[model samples]
Target: MRPLPHHRTLRPDRRPELTLSQPLETLAFTPWPGIGNDIWETVAFPNEGYSYEVWTSVTRDPEATGGLRGGVTVRQGEAIIARLTCDPDTPSQSLDVIYDLKESIGQCWDFTSRSWQTSCG
Candidate 1:
């Protein structure tokens, strides 16, 4: 694992917002076994000693609106780091999500990557 810089600081009360520390262009999604229309993808940062796993589930609207809904969860080990959901009401073009890993924005959430800079955990 890479050593954290000594000059960095941490605030116990805050969770850090982190960006992808390394380029993730090569990551690919694999179909989740026995789960139709569900897929999972994972990436590891050996130098940083952490991995990110994302699970996605897609479902078509039952009312035959010809729309779709989906949910996604991002995790690091046993810890759930982020979550996202989309439905007919959400724009299909694109969705932007920001995870406040620097501050405790809600339950089951905390920053855990101080090496990126401030309080990542």
Candidate 2:
């Protein structure tokens, strides 16, 4: 995995209204393993009343680039305000630390079926 950048930038076409230029060190990063060989990475930024979470899932296959299949979710308290899928060639950061946050919260990706499952079977 690549090192996290000092700052993260979003594609202009992805969400013109939403811009991320702050240093990533201030954000929270979480990494967790999926059902089989897949892994989920999430970076969250908290705002005044809401938070923005960027998530991506990748397989153990070294050739697979998972950035093409993730999205950004905006949430306020426990409610999801919006969800925007990422476009091709979007930029995402990978951090060195792993928090296993998703799995602890009961979220996992089923590698065989290539879908998300509440629990790994």
Candidate 3:
């Protein structure tokens, strides 16, 4: 996990717009070590006036003696706005990352809060 980037001023004064680089694609959780039992899910565009992709992936490392970790990334358009990377050694621990988006922003999962939190540039 990484420290979430600080917030940027919102353009609430500007009307929210739907300007996609491409037709929004269906988001899926694809694991890296694609083996053993794993769990994952994705949610896209959960809010009005914003397009967001949120997903999580969970897996157990056999070599780590049942250690579990999950990685998730939240993206808008093709750019990643936030990421959740589990600590390799402490697989159970996760960190959330937030990025800077120039004109748009949305919400992403915060493992610490175990809930969705606002994110912005």
Candidate with top lDDT is 2
Output the better candidate (1/3) by lDDT: 3
**Lowest summed lDDT window (length 10), candidate 3:** 94-103
lDDT of 2: 0.61
Return the TM-score for candidate 1, rounded to 2 decimals.
Answer: 0.31
Angstrom error of the Cα, residue 110, model 3: value is: 30
Between candidates 1 and 3, name the one with more favorable TM-score: 1
Give the clashing residue pairs of candidate 3, or none: 1-95
Off by over 4 Å in 3: 1-41, 45-54, 85-121
Model 1: per-residue lDDT, tens digit, 1-121? 3332233344678887555544323323232233444232222332253454433333433544434344444545656554555444443421112122212333222223211232232
TM-score of each: 0.31, 0.49, 0.29
Using lDDT as the measure, name the better of candidate 2 and candidate 3. Answer: 2
The C-alpha stretches of model 2 lying farther than 4 A from their native spots are: 1-15, 21-25, 33-37, 61-68, 88-121
Error of 2 at 93 (Å): 6.3
**lDDT scores of the candidates, listed in order:** 0.36, 0.61, 0.42
